[model samples]
Target: MAVVFDKPTLLQRIAPIFQGFDGPLVFAILLLACAGLMTMYSVGFDHGSRFASHGRNMMLAAGVLFVVSQVPPQRLMALAVPMYVVGVALLLAVFLFGIQKKGAQRWLNVGVVIQPSELMKVAMPLMLAWWFQRREGQLKPLDFVVAGLLLAIPAALILKQPDLGTTLLVVASGLAVIFFAGLSWKLIIPPVLLGMVGVVTLIAMEPQWCAPDVDWRVLHEYQRQRVCTLLDPFKDPLGKGFHIIQGMIAIGSGGVWGKGFMQGTQTHLEFIPERTTDFIFAAFSEEFGLVGTLALMAAFLFLLIRGLIIAMEAPTLFSRLVAAAMTANFFVYAFVNMGMVSGILPVVGVPLPFISYGGTAMVTLGVCLGILMSVAKSKRLMQS
Candidate 1:
């Protein structure tokens, strides 16, 4: 004989899967993801596949976030060292016999092409956070020295691949961990002062230094040209400066209000380079204008603040460090992308978080948000 039973309600069935999610964080991510989907639809108005592909990527990212958020912070720390070691080892593999693409040796091909540098974006923070957590009570200058060494190795390897944007990102992520771990003010001051002085010096000496014939030994010629281009984009209006000029036009022409969705002349006319990736902000600005730009900026600012709050309230040193690094990474992603697209900084292939169309980056972002959610949920559990 069989017994008949009533089926569980939908919420009862779904509740266990989302058992520990931080509601606000998940909602914030969903909002951004929705905006990304809408923008991608407009970006690929004529090509339905591009928009559909972006939707698929977002779904993939949402899956990653859900799966990853289920893992608690302590267990995350347990996997940190091994993940970091594998990441660095893969970077070495890329250095030794990497696949070359578009003149950069940043990919390691096993069964498929993968950018090992992307691994460091997450791994570096994990490694540093774990390192600091281990030395929580007895931290010293030497520990930071060792941390710097850990950061330098993979960063140098990626730099040799000639991917400056990713190198900067990895370095920044590691430094965020260190900074949150209470590295001295003295350690921070010199770099800030020197950077200010360097900028002043560059501006003052631009006439002779930015000359085409001069060889800049410190940076690759193309990198040096990007700096020069930022200093004065008009110097090569239709050449090195073309991207910046077009981006600026799209942004400025948007004026106080904007041209409305799918109505950006510069975007549709094909003047804005990489309109769906690096320069997506320009197209966005052209359509949404200042009001929409402010709204978007506010959303990012809220995310940043929310992530930092989670970091500050995390129960352990490792969680704090990881959370802070992840939060700072978001700021860098938003600031650098906006700066370059607005012509205030040189173009670096950094995508605008959810707004940019790319699979690997979206997955990485999903992992980041998932980790933050895990940390936040852990705090709620502790309180209960």
Candidate 2:
């Protein structure tokens, strides 16, 4: 017998590969990936490790996006419950046996100092969406209560960890899911009213509440200082106020056209804290100026719009909720970081998405993008 080699048919190989996909989503991913690489290159110009690490992270994120796009919506739905349960369990474990860093216990050492709170940022929405999907087209008041209970537990635990930024993100993610799942305006009114009332009361009672002698049982001292610092950065401009004051100065100094990349006086002089991390936005703004800032905002806006469209077109309820929540989460992250840098909000140390340099945050964002891509692609697959 003569030896023979067989060649595979093109359809046989390509058909299964594109079972689900959204062209717009792939375009968005490529565009953001380029932006991320460009910013990382600028930030890590001399630091080979940072550049190489981000490159690896981008590859890992792309792999995640590819794998998630292949998984069916039903399978993702099935994963929601167990992932949430495990996440909650890990959070509880953090309270009992966790790593204590700078007086906060937010990480667990299971051969790695894993932050359970980060998991909730993604899982909380998935869990809530799964719950809402279970009672689809037949929502009730009790459902909202159950959803609140689901949100409150992990949020409370994370707050106890004193990681306020992550706690807020996780809460916002879960709330977004519930809001999209047909949560009544009637139910939303009370929380909105109460929140407004609470802010008023806090402001009116600021003297007594913020007195150095009187301690607020709820917030840590540092947390309280941060909120107060935001109110009047001039109060302690050299101490707790250093971050906001420096950030505002850097942003203000960057006129319309900016000071040019890596040539920013404040950034080069190291006046801005965490320039490569949480406050990277200020550094970027100082260097790139108004034009670059607006361009970045445009990309984020496009992402949010496409994300909303994908959520609306999602084939399943779980997919829709997850997509919406993830989209909202991204917006919140950007809004909070920018606000903090501009001295509009307290310094809670939230990193600027794609621009800031942090492995964990970058990885988390990549995973979020992957999930969204999965939802969008699945919808496309179903329609075709």
Candidate 3:
């Protein structure tokens, strides 16, 4: 047989590109990709075309993963500031003449309609990492303030767009970068306390402060309803609260053992809303029970732990910040979606990350993972 040098193998020959692969990181990605495929199958059981679309998206994500893992961390650092500036400008464009759907304008149209906020999810951490990298030996107290400003500007815009879920995710991701970059616990404590107080105050004054007569002209009507519904879903079960009520029922009905795969009563009966998106975890719990849930959580934990180990061993501050932020984003995504599904947190329409069915989110997360892999690979190559 003649030896043939094909595209894939020939492409793999580049030194800096695909130099040292991370096994654990790759395993984590594979697990999430599998979970995505399984959940999408259920989500689009009636509409098989969705499964095909998801497959295509996964293929694209994998390609992105490969391409991004090849880029050197130093190069990624160089690309950060420019990318962040572009992201912010796109967000401004969105605010000006974005597409409005369900009374919220989060998507912009330059050539195609897309969510610029998703780009921020990747750009924010990159920018912060680059900033911290620059101030490596002499990180001042005021540096945190500058980073806070970097995070807050776009977060405020996203929040005003009333895309509460993504705004919070982006904030969490950016803060993770700062935290990993050696933010002090003393500095972290005050904000933690204030956030708790704010939550309590919101809950305490849910009726008056969140009432219609308060002239909620600042908030879109549906956003107000979502907050109110989070406080008490029973107030309007048939209206805004329907999704939460149904999701909880589906989850609670699972008991010790699940009702079995594809045999969920609530799911089959069409009682569970957004079963393949934010509420997919609830549906999975309904079908696979406690055992399945634990297995999934364990996989996520393994991924997080391995990611942190990689961050700790990274060759540079930028790599460490990028790795840690990506890991924390995964944690935040899982926590928020599960919290919302269980009715512990307000519904803000954040997806279940890999398990959810959205091309934009899947690709954004894929890119995040790619950055993590790049960091991990750089560390390994230096050691080798």
lDDT of 3 by residue, 247-288 (tens): 999988888788987788898788888777778888888887
TM per candidate: 0.96, 0.93, 0.92
Query: What are the lDDT figures for the candidates, one per model?
Result: 0.89, 0.84, 0.87
lDDT of 1 at 130: 93
Model 2 per-residue lDDT tens digits across residues 155-253? 999999889999989999999998999887987999899999987887788767767887777889999888877877887899989999999998888
Worst 10 residues of 3 by lDDT: 9-18
Error of 2 at 66 (Å): 2.0
Q: What is the lDDT, from 0 to 100, of the residue 217 in candidate 3?
A: 73
Candidate 2 residue runs with Cα over 4 Å from true position: 1-6, 9-19, 46-48, 200-208
Better of 2 and 3 by lDDT: 3
Candidate 2 scores a C-alpha RMSD against the true structure in Å of 2.7
Q: Write the per-residue lDDT of candidate 1 for residues 1-384, one digit (tens) a residue.
A: 999999999999997776666777776787777778887888777645878888888889888888888899999999899999999999999999999888889998899989989989999999999999999999989999999999999899989999999998899999999999999999899999999999999989988889989998978888999999989999999999999999999999998889999998988888888888889899899998998889889889889999998999899999999999999999999999999999888887999999998899989988888888889888987786
